[model samples]
Target: MVVVDVQNDFCEGGALAVAGGAAVAEGITRYLREHRAAYDVVAATQDWHIDPGPHFSDHPDFVTSWPVHCVAGTPGAELHPGLDTTGIDELFHKGEYADGYSGFEAHACGTGDAGAASSAASSAAGRPRDLARWLTDHGIEAIDVVGIATDHCVRATALDGARAGFAVTVLTDLTAGVAPDATERALAELADAGVTITDSGTPS
Candidate 1:
């Protein structure tokens, strides 16, 4: 499954926005148009949170309490209008409980029988399934990921996908940085860990 987090709150102008976030949507669209039939399923995750959730103040990683962003029902929480979600078959919402960063921790991947089953059998026990599990269950042995904020959620998801044993590839052109240096560092880390980084021109 291709995970896209091209939501307004992660885009150029919303709270906690990422520079070049708008480009992710367009790049993913182009990729999908070329390879829509290669997969059996497509899924996406949105950072759907509510105001005053524990995520807003519970973590020291946040510089200051962020103005509530991706709040449910808010314009900033909507998927960026530029994304072609018409190809997506499932939408998972994360950060509802404020413990999620990766899309695999989102509700659709987190609360199902597959999660329960995997939790019982794996050493990565008790962790939610998110996108990685969804892909594994559907017999997808590799993933080509593209989305917003390469240093944050995108990095987390790609790393987790690699750890989950899928051959993970990050489409660099279909992603944007949360911070240039940090994103570069994250990509380097992913590369060291065996996640392939490539432009959208690379075949899925």
Candidate 2:
């Protein structure tokens, strides 16, 4: 399962607050606690934007860029307080040097090429592990996705999962969106692309 960007910066009272983002975080935590055994590897993605760049613009276009949020070492960068991350096997960070919406863009701590990510991030151990590589290493053929901003990160992650040849399912109930119309449109687009759309009650 993939939990995408359930951070404080996307939750209520955050700089880029998405409606019900906090509730989604709580819901995902509960789901993991209850259904963790249903999956083999449970991973999460975080928008760990560190430096000040175009992604953290003073005047964001809201389409291609956003406000300063999820900066490294800041409260906004941490996951929501209500989220229980006990079962999370891996935590991938993205948006450190550029604009990143898809969870696939994140690199697992200690794995991959390690590129320009800070030493503090690499201190977690392991190499860089992108979502595709990680899933492939684990022999994952399908993925269930949930998280904040259904219209954005969730959408991008699910689409990328599908593109990566995984059977992708978006857990609608466990996700919240920044905009209703955009979320609806995104869901439609995913469906058209052959991604499954289901709620928690539905069997995987």
Candidate 3:
């Protein structure tokens, strides 16, 4: 399972706050607690930006560019408290110096962090670990994605997972999007690419 960008900056009071983002966080924790045995690996991605030149904007277009968020070494970049990440094995941090929208982007890597991300999630630091490579190494064949914004990073990550030849599924009930129309479009896009659109309650 892949949890994408459940950081403070994407939650309720975040810099790029998504409506219902915090609820999604809480819901994911509950799902993980109940369904932890359903998967072999539980990995997560965070948007840890550090001078992402054109990606961070003083006046964001809210499409290509966005307001500064998830900057390295700040409270906004930390994972949301609502997510109980006890089972996350490894963490990937992306968009350190460029605009990365996918967890597949290899900006940095970390292993083991306490619930404090206590799994040691990457944040513009740690050694790089290409996501596809990590999954391949673990012999992960299918993926279930859940997280903050359905329209952005979650979309990118699921698309990339499919392209990498994994049977990908996005647990929609565990995700929050930045906008409604965008969420609809994103789901359509994922469906077109053969990514399954489902809920956590469904058997995987």
Candidate 4:
């Protein structure tokens, strides 16, 4: 299972707060606590931006890059307070240099490339093996993704998971979107790409 960016920055009161982010955090914690056994290996991704380049623009344009957020070593970069990560097997950090919306852009810890780089270009160039290889190595054939901002990171993760040939499902109730219209469009896009959209309360 993949839990997409549930970081504080995406939640309420953070720099780039998304709607219902806090509720998503709490719900995910509860779901994991009750259904941890349903998943084989659980992993999570966070927007661990470490550099303030084009990804953090002075003038705002929320579509690409808007405000500075999820900077490395800051509290906003951490997971939401309501979320319990005890069951997570690994953590992948992304957006260290560029605008990383997909978990695949992240590198798992213990890899040499998992840290703040001197520059955004260097960090992108230094990215280690992607999430696909890691999933394949661990024999993960399917992925259930749940998290904040359904219109952005969650959408990207699910699409990438599908592209990698993994059966992907986005737990609708476990996600919060930045905007309702965009979220609807993102869901439609995912369905068009063959990703399943469903509520987490129901069984697959």
Q: What is the C-alpha lDDT of each candidate?
A: 0.74, 0.84, 0.86, 0.84
Task: State each model's C-alpha RMSD to the native.
Answer: 5.4, 4.6, 4.2, 5.1
Residues 150-194, model 3: lDDT tens digits: 999999999999999999999999999988999999999999999
**Superior candidate under lDDT, 2 versus 3:** 3
**Higher-scoring candidate on TM-score, 1 or 3:** 3
- Model 2: ten consecutive residues of lowest lDDT: 111-120
Model 2 bad stretches (over 4 Å): 110-127, 202-204
Model 4: per-residue Cα lDDT over 28-97, one tens digit each? 8889888999897788898888774787888878888779999998999998988888887777888888
Q: What's the candidate order when arranged by decreasing TM-score? A: 3, 4, 2, 1
Which residue ranges in model 3 land beyond 4 Å of their true spot?
113-127, 202-204
Compute the lDDT for candidate 3: 0.86
Top-down lDDT ranking: 3, 2, 4, 1
User: How close to the true structure is residue 187 of candidate 4, measured as C-alpha lDDT?
Assistant: 100
C-alpha RMSD between model 3 and the true structure: 4.2
